[model samples]
Target: MKAFKTSKRVLSSLIAIMLLVMSCQSFLAADGDEKKPLNIPEITLENLQVRGGSTTYLVDNPPYSETAPTMRDFDFGPGSDNMQDAYIVYNYGNEVMIESLTLVGWWPKDQAVKNISLEYFKDGQWVTAQENIEVPWQTSGGTEEEVEITLTEPVTTMKFRVKINSAYHSWSDKICMHLMRPNGYIVTEFKPLTDAIAQAEKLVSQVLIGNKDGEFSQDAVDSLNAVTNEIKEKLDAGLVTADDIPVMIEQIETAIEEFTSSQNPMENAPAAEAENLTVSLGNTAYLTDRQISTGMTVSFTDSENPAYLTLDFSGKNLNATGLTLLASSSDKFTLNMSAEAEIDGVWTEIAAGTDFNYRCDVQGTEGHKITFDSCTASKFRIKINSSTAESFTVYEILWDGLYDTDTSAMDNLINKANSIIKNPASSDYPDLLDILKIVLSPAENQETSILANQGKIDTITQLLSEAISAFDGLAQYEKGDVNHSGSLEIEDVTLIQKHIVKLLQETDFFDEYLADVDNDGVISIKDATSIQIAISSK
Candidate 1:
């Protein structure tokens, strides 16, 4: 009875947190929304031209148009050896006060200069940000450079001309520029993600099996927290990323509620869903939610990139008959999506790519569906060949498929892994990690063949069984004790801080499942701040 009481108390508190959070979301959203909109007149671009640089070293990028940056190498024009010799006159129809000006060089670091200086028209006057900034500066993200410059004050002008007499670079001798911008976008469409998380958390405690301290599944918790972190990353960058937020949040919520599904596959099993597919472009994980952008989806990739992306189901032993590629935007574009299969590691295009058409603001026909011969070979690849839109954004990839191997045992293992990850004891770390590897088996770069490959589906089941036999039982853990030190201290806060700053880099510190002090699904910097405050109050 006492144990039941304790469990009830914890749950009651959590429910309260959920309710309070939901009530304040509207208020929070309102706070972020603009109250008094900034008044600014419309502006137009007129006959703009480049001047002075070495006319011999012409920068070729198409000026102020085209979604894809089409400027050829050495696009910065009228290129004289003198950097000041090159600049553009931006003639506008109306004069407006712009808060900032940023010149974008779509490349990575090391290849471009980090800093630059130029004089531009402001209030009908030509001036530079720093009179002392005489020489060229350095740069980063060499593959795609985004150089941002902020002015001391808003520049009011009708016509602005910049003169760049010189520039500097550490790697490539030539400088190629992309686009310039005013400021980053602010996304207000976040209610879907927040509402989904809140609803899922409200229901989770009701489904938890045991009364132990870390009774809930950590994997489900981590999955929720991971999305939370990814959303934070996008918001910090000031990017509008809510297009797929509703879908992603829904998928996660479904994953959380999987326990509500029937345990017997015969009764009901997980069908082929859109979430299983992986995407990338030539060697780089372009659409992968793994980086700065939400691993769930990305903005856009230049279809013109010779090395395009492939969505593959090569190692899952799953034979797919058809595919559906989703476009985030409604604008009509040539959809160059194709399905290919590999025989002896060679890819043969199975479906000829076609144009994908959609009318923005129109209903239906937002995705392109392709049918193909069913094959389970590891070489199956799907590529977005090209699009009418210079760059197109493909968010979700869905397929119709079935596993060749028996999945009864696999499903059972997945359930067990989810359970163990949610409430791991101190000694469950090694096995917990092994379980993760199994669930995420047949990962990219795994050997291609079943005979020589260690990534076989059977291997995961066998490893999972062994790990289960070694369960270390459960232990109570303080919510902020990330290091499993048995007590919450200043060091625990520091460890989480280090993880946030990229100093420690360990993502599995939350095995105890109690490290999420606020139960927001994420162990973010805010959690660290909360811990410090808790310590002070004590």
Candidate 2:
């Protein structure tokens, strides 16, 4: 009885195996002769939408009279039952050669696929290239397992046949294929103004998300946020507004390209250190008579060049008979003397490229002292160097603490002096004198005149400010009204005519302000005629 039971069990197992084999054969032959007719119609696509960059395509069976061809229905059972078979055809549209191809899907469970075969159609005939390209069914499917079959020569059609020599575990769906092509684009960079607007709009969209009903719409909020951030970052950092966007983008892109090309960072580092500027100090021709007895050196060398250097003297009335080059040849010396004196005494040697500077010390004083001696040297640069009583390394340093002043004052003074020299009675000497008095006076005593002079300054400032404002306002108005009729370009020149008539209505010559190009304030036929002339010409 035990022997009979064993035999029966073996028979049952054999019968099950036979049934599985039949099922596998049926799956492989599903698209072959012994199957119901597939009613799905052939479909083709033309003029596909391509963004000219990274794009992907998937073979999606469209909803139609039939469910369409799918690999899910093909069942490849456990154990070596029957051969598994599947075929795929791809056509290269517009003669574009396929750079790369990949087939992807979940792995089969039971066993691995024995091989894959490829065929190509060319010269009006089909040709089989490979019959056994191995693919492991138990392994995961991705780009890693992609079979790179290089044709070397161009072909119009590619056919792949996946064959299962042994039964493997089933997969939920058939594998999908992807063909990759490098990106191409015509517009490499964006327009500056347009890019700014787009960025603003994007920010607005993010900030106003889900706040559709708020006072500021998503777009407005984004625009304001973007513009505000841009102003704060760029303007504060001092970036110029008129720079071209493409130029900047190209620069950044070029940097990226260079980094990618070189790949080695240290290769771009500085090869060697740079040389420093040489600077030193030397004695004046004649050390002050006081300096002679002080047991102190009147000269020094600027140890740290490109560094600030200063010299100071205080206490007892310091006096020097004369200043001499003092034997050492050097290029650095600047001095401020209270009394006119000789620079560098006899027998002292002056070096090449060396310079001597002298000025009066009036820092906290009412005025400066006159020079007592002559500065000896064939050549020397003499600068005011400021009346402040501080040793400054650079000339610009002396102007640092000064309050903002009208640089035009100097020009005005010079002009006034010239006018006085030319025809003194015809010019306004009092006004010129008043302006100069404020300029030449010591800083401590400048308060009263400054306060009294504010109104006159304001009048002049206002005239200039108003003229500029008017011109800018008119330009902006015209820009906004691009239609250019008097409105923009669309409507009649109503505003223009009104302004013209207003100009004509002005009567006072000196007091009333109008487009009095002649400065003779009365707005008469001349102003009206000027407007008329401009309009006619336009």
The prediction achieving the highest lDDT against the true structure is: 1
- Candidates in order have lDDT scores of 0.46, 0.29
Best by TM-score: 1
Model 1 worst lDDT run, 10 consecutive residues = 1-10
What is candidate 1's lDDT per residue for 315-412, written digit by digit as tens? Answer: 54557687676554435556566777666678777777765665533542255678888866644545655555543345445566755555345445
Tens digit per residue, CA lDDT, model 2, 425-523: 323446544443343332223333433232344444443333233223122222212122233221223332444466433332111122332333343
User: TM-score for each prediction?
Assistant: 0.27, 0.17
Candidate 1 TM-score, C-alpha based: 0.27
Candidate 2 residues lying further than 4 Å off, grouped into runs, are 1-85, 93-100, 108-114, 136-167, 170-538
